[model samples]
Target: MLERLFESTLWNSRFIVILAVVFGLIGAVILFAVASIDIIVTAKYVVATYLSGTHPENFHQDVIGGIIGAVDLYLIGVVMLLFAFGLYELFISEIDVAKESEHDETQLLAIHSLDQLKDKISKVIVMVLVVGFFQKVGYTQYSGALDMLYLALSITAVSVGLYFLGKVGK
Candidate 1:
């Protein structure tokens, strides 16, 4: 009886994962809010600049950079969401509402195994990295032909990696 009680307590300890699920969801919400605010601020900047009839030297680049930064944040938020949902399903219980949803979008959050969760989170992380790479490249100045060639090669590498990433599990 003592051994059975100990085993039962050990198994119930998995509920500790609820802490991670709750915090992960909160983090995702914060990220999404911050990204949305960044987009709004960028829009205001654009409108104010055009209305003033004075275009800063790097106006376009700045706007693009802001948008890209927000996109990066949004992607990270998605990763957090997936992490939360996957953990909850794996350790706690399947989300009943998601299972009953008629929309296909709910399928995206459905995770049956730890490997599937990792793959989903990793894909979003790669996308976030790609966005961050472009955001930095947009602000950088190339000094010579070699620099430009390196940039081209880096872009090609990213593209090829993405192509193979898409092929996985298919």
Candidate 2:
């Protein structure tokens, strides 16, 4: 009887993780909303610039940067969603919708293990970082050959990093 009581108590504790996972889902939803807003605002900026009829210096770069920033936000939101769903599926239960879907094997939300979840999130995060770096470099001005060389080196480094990230688990 004592062993039964202990087993029951331990099993019940699994539900505690549900609270954290729900909060994470909510956070991901909020991030997605914010990213949507950001895209809308960027569109407005582009439209206003177009209406002004004056090609300001760096206008193209600014618009590109804004778009990239929005993409970064979206990628971050994706990471959050993957984290939440991964935790839920790992600790709680399989997602019914994913399980019933015809394309269950191809869906991003079909996380079968913690390692898969981590890999998915890491790839998205690396993409976000790469976009962020590009957004910054878009506005950077190089006054000398050395500065241009440094920029080239930075690009090479980022490419190498991405290559290694892709090669993981292989």
The candidate scoring highest on lDDT is 1
Instruction: Please give, for residues 48-127, the per-residue lDDT of candidate 2 as tens digits.
Output: 98899877788889788877887888889888888888888888888887878888464778888878998999899999
Locate the minimum summed-lDDT window of 10 residues in model 1: 98-107
lDDT of 1 by residue, 1-170 (tens): 99999999999999999999999999999999999999999999999999999999999999999999999999999999999999999999999999898999988999999999999999999999999999999999999999999999999999999999999999
Off by over 4 Å in 2: 104-107
Off by over 4 Å in 1: none
CA RMSD of each candidate after superposition: 0.7, 1.7
